[model samples]
Target: MTSKKSITRRLTLLFVTASSVVLLALGFVIASSVGKHFEEQDMEVLTGKMALAGHTLEQLKSQNDLERITHLLDNSLVGHHGLEVLILRPNHEVIFATPNANFPIELVSVSAAQNSRRPITWTQGEQTFRGIAAELPTGISERSRVIVAVALDIAHHQAFMRSFLQTLWIFVAGAAALTGFLGWAAARRGLAPLRALREQAQVVTAQQLSHRLSVESAPVELAELAHSLNEMLARLEEAFHRLSDFSSDIAHELRTPVSNLMTQTQVALSRQRSADDYRSILESNSEEFEHMARMISDMLLLAKAENGLVVPTREAVDLAAEVLALFDYYDAVTEEKRLNLALEGNAEVSADRLMLRRALGNLLSNAVRHSAANTTVYVRISASLDAVSICMENTGDGIAQEYLERVFDRFFRVDPSRQRSSEGTGLGLAITKSIVLAHGGTISVESIDGTTTFTIILPRAP
Candidate 1:
């Protein structure tokens, strides 16, 4: 496979190629125009010279005046270098010729009538020539016809054009090279912002996720990139903080039970004890073990839920039946707290039966634990065309505004001191949330006017 090229090199090559093509095209056009211009100029000169020679022939009074005509031709041809003149008689014998003139005989043979001219081009050795031939009327006799030829050398003009084209090619190549260099330089300069972004990104780590790209200072084209990178950094930073907090909370929660078990075991083994005492110590240790086991189980369940490993079997679950079952389970605790439990309204939701039951049990348990004495804990279910909603409200000292949002977070509690009278692991609400989410539902909590309400909404069965 071939390696990819950089944008700078690509742009530079593009610029050079385009410039070279344009320059070559322009050169061809100019060269053709110049060649045509020279041909036209030479043709005009040759035509005039032919006309002059014909007029001189017409002015001759008789055939005996040929000498005067020759003299006139020689005088007219003076000071005109590279110009050749020749006069032929009716029998094609040269009658007059300029000194050193070597006009082609073929030019005289291809003759035109009097007052008419024909132009022709021929080359001799290294010299190219353009000329015109015309038949002239000699006044000496009716049978005396004179053919006049006038030619101009074009070798110098052809040489000039060759030199011009060579120079033009050299200039075009130089301009293309210079343009390529400039294009590369401009591309590099324009990409400074991207380079800066890369450098900034290189410095970022898990510990330094707070650093953000300066979007406002970036070029308009790169501003969106910078903003998106900054937003990603913000999310990574929040996730990092959450990970750190999760680690700390897990350590704290586990340490309590483990430490308690260790201290109690050490106390029991401090001296010889009766079988009842040993059994009682073992039972106490068993409670702490159970608590730690519950915490670990809840953590595993949450992890599986979050990773989409928990696939719930959907079924029609009656909300009232689930609430009644939970009330039965928590009857002893509610009776001790003198809290009354009430279930109102009925709805069926599309959910996993076991998962829904567990979620409602957790919510009811939490409400009963927090409700004031003799206060009623209410479970209200409602249904719409497409969804079912369950609201669990309990009368108590409501949660603080700040803690309401995080009440469903794992191990979070409104009580900052974490003091608990019940055998709760602080994962009840968190488990409820995970179960609800696994069933394609949402759970939210709000506390107002000495009342805390937990709401769960699930899609209705089709």
Candidate 2:
């Protein structure tokens, strides 16, 4: 696997590369411009000297005037150091030449033939010169035009340019290093908020899930990520709290039944009871065991549902029919309590038959158990375009406002003082919620004016 570079290092490298490219480009332009300037200055001096030589040759009337022309040319060269001039006839015979300044024969021949004024550079031994050549007319009609070449030594300029280039590259290297350091520092400072967020997250454990990352202090680009992380932490904290509560509730629920069984057995064993008395105690103990078995089964079902393992078998289930069936099943209890079962409206939903029946049964049982005598337990079904709603409302002491959200939580009860040995396991509402969710539905509750309402919404049949 390829190792990834840190943001700081990547940014620094990019900065260095960009700066180096720009600096090198500027340096190249500068070097080229400076070299051209030196060539231009040298060409100016060489051209001027050639012009003077041409003027002297133009004054030549005959062979007699040649000596005076050469003398005048030699005198004109005076204090012009590092300058050389060569004049040649059409026969390639030298008319005048600088002593010991032997310009190359090839350069003279090529420049004379081309008659170009553009400067050319050539090196001789330890010296470099820029020179130009032109054809000039003589005063004598019998003689042909003369070729005049002029050169200027540019060794000092070359030396200066070489040093300048060396200094420029060194400066660019140093600048790139400095820019890289500054870029790394800037990148590190820019990412400081992420480090802080990570540090805050690192301290978060199951026990410390309540810790939240600050979104306000984060950079705009990372603000959304921080907000999402905070939301996740909030969910984790709530889940952890629920898990803690579930652990305590399960232990408490199981302890009572086990303690009852143990106490009953101990009392029965201590005193030799008759066969009927022993049988009665065993029968009573069986009830507690059955209750425990039901609670454990409900918890297992809830666990399966939570893990998305409860795949409901899809079928069309009638809401009114299920409620009527549950009412008949609980007829004795409802009749004994003198409570009325009033169901209105009818809707159909596509759901698992047994699961749907179980959910409705749990809600109806709760409604019956909690309803005040002579008050009606209402089951209302309503249908919309895409969904069906079934509401179970009971006339009883309503649940508190704070507990509405947690009512469907496992083992949660409106009355904490309610005995664990109550007829139904506390997991009924939780199981109902899980079943409804398994069928891709939602369950909600609201209490108002001494009436408690539990609503289940499922997708309507296609």
Candidate 3:
């Protein structure tokens, strides 16, 4: 089994561990420093008392007064607990010592005198007691003067410091726990946005492409990411819509021809007939089928091109030559229809030859289909520094303003009832727009009065 990792838990653990380390170091320092100060104070008091006791013993008027001196000493030290005193000569012989039993009589500290005149100091039994030793200030009131010494117990001061440190450590540990808990809470609060982001991503799928993270409520750091995801979802939704519309368009466009073809095929095969009659019927039906197939193929091609599946093979081409060639091809038909095939100046542009041909061809077909018979359909190609435009204007029943924008939509028609019944795929304008867009160009239609013009603008040759 594995444990789940939590950010809050990690932050708390780290904070607590660091706090504990700092508190432990502080405790050690405080204990050492405070204990030293108290011990020094206790030693100073003991040293002073020792001197005073020696002076008192030496001030006695006669050697015969030893018993009186002892009694006075006992009375003086009665309330002074933990005090032990000893007096010694240069011969290391004891002259007097404190009667207090709570402290050892002479062995509390082994330190020698600080000088011939000052006391030495020591701490006893793991610093539980403070001790001082000194030469008894026994004066040579005579050469045989007696010495007095004292020891004071100091365990109480060290004990107080220890108790204080123990209580302080408990407080620090409690504060550490509280701070650790708070750190966990703060981490959780700060990371809430990330948690929400994760949950939202988990619930999202292609089915919910419309769903997007809310940038307004998200943290500033996540704002750009939320916006980018929303944009991607929007593009996907549009692509899906285009695919759906394209599928429906294909189904509607193929219905009538497929039904008619099936009927014609079955009927033509059902009965015996003369070979000429069979040939004529087969030929005509074959041409109709070919026309339907061509329309379907063109529609499919336009769909693929719009979707960017078919990339144009771009190249430099002589625009005027391509127009002239097309002019010759359509000139006979235009003449028979009494339309004018006009030529403009030569222009150069960078584009895909095949795609441009299709664009121009679609424009010519539109002109032929809509223009009045025996009237002039004018063609013009113009150029500037950065761009070139090919325009075709046909004299005809000009399109209504409302239908101008709708012309580029697949399967749409000016007449509502003929939308699905027209020979044209209704996608020629749509395909022209797609190809123009793919080539990094623009196309537009303008119609007023009896004039309808289609314009194609392409980038100029570099």
Candidate 4:
């Protein structure tokens, strides 16, 4: 593939091309005007000479005056260096001619045929001339009319024009070169902001994603680009931090159950145990294995949800009915804690039934585990023109304000000092948020006055 030219080179080339064209046009106009002016000056001189020659021809009374007239015309042109004259009778016989003047014969033929005084140009050997010819009436009886042709030598005009053209061409060439250099410099200076932006972007890596381009310092044309790049960098930095935290959380979560298994196995191997003792140890290890399995499964589900791989099968689902089903599943736990389950309102939504149930189940289980005994757990569902709202409120010692925003982060616990429990994995709220998001819904939590409420908004069935 052929390499493309840089912007600076392209701009410089275009500027030079345009400037050269304008300069050439101006030069042509100047040269043509000057040449025409020289012609006009020569024609004025030629016209005056023709009038003089005509006046001299009119003085003729007979053939006798012709000889004196010839002498008079010759003396009249004595001081003129490049002027020539010719006079002829009606019979085409030359009455007088300048010595070695060598005027073109075609000039006489055209002038006589047209009988015009308009100036014409012709070349004789190395000399160019502008001249005019006309028929004049004379006082002689038999020779009543004569041809008076006057010519001017224009060798000086030609020499000056040649010199002017050479100088014009030289100036145009120099100007083009100077303009090209200036254009390249201007292009380079104008693109300095883009170069700076590129340098800033180049310094960004996984470890240094916090670098941002300066939008305020950028040129107006590149300001939007710089701002967008800054936004992208911010997102990358955030994602990197989240990934780091996720990896650390996974390690922390797995270490507990693994340590328990190892400790139990070591204790069992330290002695020869009876069948009942071995059976008890194996059962306890099985519970730990089950907890690990559940944690791993939840992590995988969250991953799939984050990457948009969790596509839901849509159907019409009743939010109230799903809440009732969850209450039934947790009936034993509620009775054991002396807690009451209550629901209000009812709305239908288009969602994946299983995913929606799981999301609600996670919220319900969390509410049941955290609620105070003899308190009420309420589920409310409402519908609008476009959406359905499901809010789960439970009475408890409530989450603190500071930890509200991070409730949906994986493996995050409000009380970090608490030991890991088999009652639940910390991934419930995170997985619930992901599932709600997959169904084109939003979830948020608020805690106040010893009550914690988790509200979910899903699009309503059409």
- Using lDDT, give the best candidate's number: 4
> Residue 85's C-alpha lDDT in candidate 1?
85
* Per-model tally of clashing residue pairs: 0, 0, 5, 0
Candidate 1 residue spans exceeding 4 A from truth: 1-4, 43-125, 128-152, 269-278, 303-321, 324-340, 348-354, 373-375, 385-387, 416-423, 434-442, 458-462
TM-score ranking, high to low: 2, 4, 1, 3
Q: Least accurate stretch of 10 residues (summed lDDT) in model 4?
A: 100-109
Best of the two (1, 2) by TM-score = 2
lDDT for residue 162 in candidate 3, whole number 0-100: 71
Model 1 lDDT on a 0 to 1 scale: 0.83
Using TM-score, give the best candidate's number. Answer: 2
Off by over 4 Å in 4: 46-80, 84-124, 130-151, 266-283, 304-316, 335-339, 417-419, 438-440, 459-462
Each prediction's RMSD over C-alphas, in Å, is 5.3, 4.0, 7.5, 4.2
Pairing residues by index, what is the TM-score of model 1?
Answer: 0.75
lDDT of each: 0.83, 0.87, 0.74, 0.88
- Per-residue lDDT of candidate 3, residues 294-359 (tens digit): 777888788788778877787888887887777787877777777776666678788889888878
Give per-residue lDDT, candidate 2, residue 151: 88
| lDDT by residue (tens digit), candidate 2, 326-346 | 889999999999999999999
lDDT (tens digit, per residue) of candidate 4 on 1-462: 999889889999998999999999999999999999998888888888888887887778877897667798988899888898888776667888888566666667678669777787888788888788888888786448887788888889999999999999999999999999998898899998889999989999998898888899999999999999899899889878877887898999999999999999999999999999999999999989989999999999998998789999999898888889999999999999999999999988888999889999999999998899999999998888999899999998689999999999998889877666734679999999999999888999999987999999988752
**Residue 292, candidate 3: C-alpha displacement in angstroms:** 4.5
Q: After superposition, how far is residue 48 of candidate 1 from its true place, in Å?
A: 5.7
Q: After superposition on all CA atoms, how large is the RMSD of candidate 2?
A: 4.0
TM-score of each: 0.75, 0.80, 0.64, 0.80
Prediction 4 global C-alpha lDDT = 0.88
